[model samples]
Each structure stands twice: as structure tokens, then as C-alpha cells.
Target: MAIVVVGGSTRNIGKTSVVAGIIRALPEMRWTAFKITQFGHGVCSANGEPCDCETAEHTIAVSEERDALSGTDSARYLEAGAVKSFWVRTRQGQLAEAMPRIRKELAATENAIVESNSILRFLRPDVYLSVLDPATADFKDSAKLFLDRADGVLLPEGELGRPTWKGVSLRLLEGTPVFAMMPPIYVGPEVVAFVRGRLAAVAADV
Candidate 1:
């Protein structure tokens, strides 16, 4: 099976959109999609909502998304043609607790796509795409740490412009195949084609 991981520097930059678009664009992959979320203190990982629960026992939750119209990120995966969709939640520093379940889920799928930067800690995907918005300065530390590992990057539409993130040299992005993200879709045919080729190569090797 092939696994594709989509990650980004920060929130609301269309990482979810990119995953959904790939599922829609390549239905034959029969992708099983996962949205992994690690919530901060007092937040519920299962729902990505804030809660007062204070314990490591409540740190991890994984739930399948059944409602395509529910408007949740995992639900959007189903609506976009993923065969199965799941949301995995873990406390900010507790993703390790959820690895066994995550591994089992990926093992059962013919192909899997995960929306997470932290999951990279445990698994190396066949394709890892990072979404970046040069205009957005708030970079997640996890995303920043894994930045150079991306197979390719999806950038917001328009010029490269000045990067506001200090300590993040332009050299970090060097040699990466950067694709322009156009509006609502966020993913283009080129990105899809690159992914397809990567997966196909894996299949061929197998």
C-alpha cells in the first residue's frame, strides 16, 4: 500500500483542501484518509474542541467519520471520494499513545493519505507534501522541523514574495518542487500527477 502525507506550516492554509482535492482527483486510489489532530492543553483531541478534561488517559481518540455533509475535516475527506475517513486526536505531546491504532488502520487500506505533520514522526510516507504560505509567519514548530523532508511544497497563489519567518532561510525551500495553490481547490493537476507517479513507482517496485 502507498501512503501519502499532507502537512503544512500552520492552520487554515488549505492542507485539508489539498487532501480532499487529491481524493477527488484520483478516485481510483481508493484512498482511506485520516486527519490527525494534536490538541493543546484543555482541548479534546477527538473533536478538536476545548474541554476541561485534565488527564493523560484522555489523551488519545480516533473516530471514523460517517457524515460526509457534517463539514468536519475528516467528513470532507469522505465527501471528496475517500473510501474511508478517520479523525485521530492526541494530546499535544501524546501522539505516541495512538500509534498502534494508527498503524492498524493504515495496514488495512489499499492506499492511505494522512493530514498531519506529527504523524511523520512514526511513519515515512510514500509522498509527503507540505503546504506553505510565505505570507503567513506563524509556523508550527513540528512543521518547521520537518520542512525539508517534504517531497514537494504547495504554495499560495502569486509571487514568492518576502518571507516573514525569521530564522527560516530561503535555503530551506531550495530544490523543492513548489506548486502554486489556486484558490478553493488548493491542489492542481500537477500535484496530483506527481503523487500518482510516486504511488505508481511504489507499485512498480513492489
Candidate 2:
């Protein structure tokens, strides 16, 4: 199965839009998409809010999204034509507890796409794309940790000029391909073509 993982430097930077765009652009992939939400530090996984409960109880939770009109990220995936979609919720550092299920799901799927930077710790996807916006200053450490592993990058429209993110240099993405994207239409024809070509090449090699 081909895995396309899409992550971003920060939240609300069009990561979901990009994932949905890809799924829409390539309807034949019949992608089983996943949107992972990790609640870090003092957050409740079951309720996604602050609670007095211990972290163990909220180790991991996975649920299939059935309603395309639910107005959730996973629902967006379904709305975009994904054959199946799931939302994985886990404690900040407890993702390992969900891997057995994740692995089994991947094994049974034809093609999969995930939206999380931390997943790189468990599996190496066929294509890993990092979506970034220099306009956003809050960069997640997980995103930075796996930035170099990105097969390609999706950036905002217009010249990026020099990025101001601390400890992140242009050198890190010196040779990786960058595709300009705009909101609401995060994945354009050119980017779609690039992804299709890359996946096709991967299939040919197999």
C-alpha cells in the first residue's frame, strides 16, 4: 500500500485542507484517510479537555467517521471521497498504544494517508509531505524533527522570501520540491500531478 503522510509546522495551516484536496484530486486511490489528534500535557483524551483523571485511561482512542457532514477533519476526508476515514486520539506521548491497530488497518488497505508529524516515529510512509507557512510563527517540535524526512513541501502562494522560524534554515529544504498552495484549494493541478507522478513511479518500481 502507498502511504502519503501530510504534516505541517503548526496547527490551522491548511493541513486538513491539503489532505482533503489530495483525496479529491485522486479519487481512484480510494484512500483510507486518518486524522490524528494528540492532546499534549494535562489534557483529557476522552473529552479533549482538562480533567482530573490519569493519563492511562485516555491512552488511545480510534473511531471511524461515518458522517460526511459531521464538520470534522475526518469527515472532511470522507467528504473528499476517501473510502474510509478515522480519527485517532491519543495522549501526547502514548501513540505507541495505537500502532497495532494502525498497522493492521494499513495492512488491509490499498492506499492510506495520515495527517500527523509524530507518526513518522512509528512508520516510514511512501511519501511524506510537510505543509508550512512562514507567516505562522509557532512551529511544532515534532514537525521540525521530521522536516528533513519530507519528500516534498506544500507552501503558501507567492515568494516565501527567507523564513524566520528559529533553528530552521533554508538549507534543511534545499533540494526538496516545494509546491505553492492557497487556502480552500490547497492542492492544485500541478501539485496533484506531482503526487500522481510520484505514486505512479513508486508503483512501477514495485
Worst 10 residues of 1 by lDDT: 45-54
| lDDT (Cα, tens digit) per residue for candidate 1, span 1-206 | 88999998888889999999999999998999999887776765434467643446677788999999998999999999999999887778788999999999988999999999998999989999998888988888888889889999998883568977766766877898889899975878898899999888988998
Model 1's alpha-carbon lDDT is 0.87
- Cα lDDT of model 2 by residue, 21-119, tens digit: 999999999999998888767664333477543445667778899999999889999999999999888778778988999888888898999999999
| Top of the candidates by lDDT | 1
Candidate 2 global TM-score: 0.91
Off by over 4 Å in 1: 43-57
Residue 182's lDDT within candidate 2 is 72
- Give the clashing residue pairs of candidate 1, or none: none
Best by TM-score: 1
